[model samples]
Target: MSSSTPAAPITGAAPSSLCAREPHVPAERLVAEMVPPPRFDSVRFSTYIPDPNQPSQTEAVQVLETFAAGLGGAHATGAGRRGFFGFGRAAKAPKAPSGPRGVYLDGGYGVGKTHLLASLWHATPAAPELKAFGTFVELTNLVGALGFQQTVKTLSGHRLLCIDEFELDDPGDTVLVSTLLGKLVEAGVALAATSNTLPGKLGEGRFAAADFLREIQGLSAHFRTLRIDGEDYRHRGLPEAPAPYADEQVTRAAHATEGASLDAFPELLAHLAKVHPSRYGALTDGVKAVCLTGVVPVPDQSTALRLVVLADRLYDREVPVLASGVPFDELFSEEMLKGGYRKKYFRAISRLTALARDAKRLVR
Candidate 1:
């Protein structure tokens, strides 16, 4: 629960509240927003700073650059120019390229896999509309919203599809995406994905990928996995996150900053439950900063996972977060930290810590 006392209200501008938003994202908007989020919007291969000690990082860049080059001319146009939802007249399907149809980046978090992935999205010789980049969750959500067949029809004409943070925890999602990818591959679409787990090693602790070996094997055959080894780059040499601010300070900062959303942490979590996870990005639309009071450890797994999605969306939009109470690192319980979703929790902490640091400038 948050503190009872409220901070003094601002004189001029009023702060927005995330708890007040219940964004409704239409299917067309979902299709449009599939491109890279703001954080990586302009990131190109040249911008990636590889760790000199990690040779594989550089090797990945070289291999991906060649891979992008190979997808030139005929591959880029994808048989013919198609409008949104595959409306344009179709031409003969291009000859499917021999060898691997895609690249899979297998590495630990903060190893620049996403940066490399987005760079490949940018480097590929295709118009922005012809290439798509999004998180694995977003991809699944699109399927849920548009239906599997509609999704295939929508993306099959695309030259490339890049998925980040590919998850293998849910056996259903693993199988669903595997079948989806098979259809897309056969349509001559190139693919690239980033994940902490290797394709063959997916679903190790949670569910057995071997149970669906035929589907998993078909998906794996399309990708040439590149192993990148490195430490978490976000904290490589950065200072520790600034300590949490007082509740009054956070609220005051929120009111003073334009386009900021102020909310009690618990209340915000409750609000998230009512909104679909697919609309999380839309929920944060135009929110320049996020301010919360009574920040505490998440109550349960479901709530914690929702927070992870929200954190990813906020980080994608480069929205700084100002908060009071427990630090981001302590938001998950010890048992939860050691559980199957630890990577997600850790990634959330890393991103939230960075955003917290960004919020420091907003404090008086």
Candidate 2:
């Protein structure tokens, strides 16, 4: 031990030997230990499924690489040596691009847009202080729970923010999200987002294009919009899976067998609203399977929205859903399907159609 090191403090629980060893530990190792691991450690570029047939695949790769470079700070170029000592002098620090640039990935459902966003989030070398990843719903929920300004304050600490499923369905959401993105960009937070809709056409059939455009005007200015063209990967040949529920037999539980059915009428919407949007991606929770009997028309816009969130969760988790009321397609009225939120409904249909096809019926 260094002579300058002080005697270790005595504690009842900790041994004197252990306390004494702390002084011997290197400061550099301690500093390294203090640095936390990346928040979205599970996502990475290597896990992204790339297709050579997709023309946008190359552009996507370049975008991620360049974004990563920007996060790491550009490397200084050519160096000239000095006279007498001939010691190499450090080059000037390259000026970082002025403001954070965002990338918006637009594509059809299940075209791996979210996967690419995750890859970018994972591959980017961001400081722990400057990174966060959340679905658009989750982030909106965050804003709802925490006021817009507070949410901005919390997220602005990060240099990069990655959002999945970035769609503007609600009028209020259009305003809130537009403001949030503007604030984030102003705060120098780079954004990477995945969505099923393009910028100019967002909230198209539901709200006035002028209003929606005004909302996203700031985002449109800074974000480089890229279109990802591909077929729906989730719609491929599906296997015949077992039923989500059974006949007349009734139960209040979430997951049930062939002889037992789970009530879907009043409870499904309740359950959907009960969970946090951040958890909407995994709303099934403890259930191994799910079946809904007494399925009826989704009455209001709020309920339809809740169902949209639920369907997204079930589809992402590959949870099968069984219904008894209206056909899955008719669950939402034609008006609702043609309304402003139709994009969400369309996505739900795409997913539910696949789920229903694979779902089994319980034998009486």
Candidate 3:
């Protein structure tokens, strides 16, 4: 496969290498790609099969449906008043809604929070352009790429904004996103987010929770917390992840499979450092599967976090991960897993395991 190309065809030839590709995502593409990823593109409240044992799952759906309905009424009645931007100065902004302006779905790795969040996005009555959905990392990256004020101006027009895997790992990001969301709420944008941590407890282990809370107090107050408890739906009754395949087997599968990328795990990790995390999604564009050899535990916190982002993008695209060496569970060190970023590492493991399961057929 040619290293110059972004992706190669499946022609029983040597597969493309992720390490060889550096994707450049234009700012507009970032904004345009803010909708739910392909995996949850069609998820809706009706399609979400809530665990019969978890009543909060069912309640979340009902509340979100009502929330969607409320947005419909507001949009229908106020459409004419707000010009092109929902918060134009021609008309005085209506009083901000009383009570929480958003819903925060707090739970573990796979309780279908994302499914429900996307369902709410799909349920909202506004046009597709009027609703935005993206991960916390993506949101922060957007602000970084577009500048803070511009991001606020761009999203302030939306009727609903759904943020998945909301992160409080960085103090700066917490303050930035909090202030941005506060602006959007004042403009009447309905907010919804899903996270492993609750609103009040966002930065508990990662940083000083007290300072984080103080910075985001106004934004947190706008969110109504909904706790959904359940086991990871992905692995609820599934068998344990298959053992890593041999390097030769992974390489052979890469050569035999169409639209696959072959890379040494360490080489790919090094390549990730050269490219911005915001472009990770674009890096996998047109790639059907990922095959990595010599997979081992990540060396440090920064690398592990980068791997988590890559794992997320690959999972979002439903790309099967064929890897040799360590299993997904061992990617992070024990200390790393017990640290503040534990939830992220665990979520990455769960997602990568699911993708690994998908790759089993490729090897066969």
What are the per-residue Cα lDDT tens digits for candidate 2 across 181-267? 877765556778878777767777766667567676655665678788777766644563333343343232222342222445656
Each prediction's Cα lDDT score? Answer: 0.86, 0.61, 0.87
Candidate 3 per-residue lDDT over residues 1-364, each given as its tens digit: 7668664443478899888888999899999999999999989899999899999989988888877766764442232333222332334444554467688999988899999999889998888999999999999999999999999999988888999998788789888888999888777677899999878777778887776667767667878898998999989999988899999889889999999999999999999999999999999999999999999999999999999999999999999999999988999999999999999999999999999999999985
Model 1 Cα lDDT, one tens digit per residue, 243-339 = 9999988888998898888999999999999999999999999999999999999999999999999999999999999999999999999988888
User: Candidate 3: worst 10 consecutive residues by lDDT?
Assistant: 76-85
* Candidate 1 colliding pairs, count: 0
Q: Candidate 2, overall lDDT?
A: 0.61
**How much lDDT does candidate 3 score?**
0.87
Ranking by lDDT: 3, 1, 2
**What's the TM-score of every candidate structure?**
0.90, 0.69, 0.91
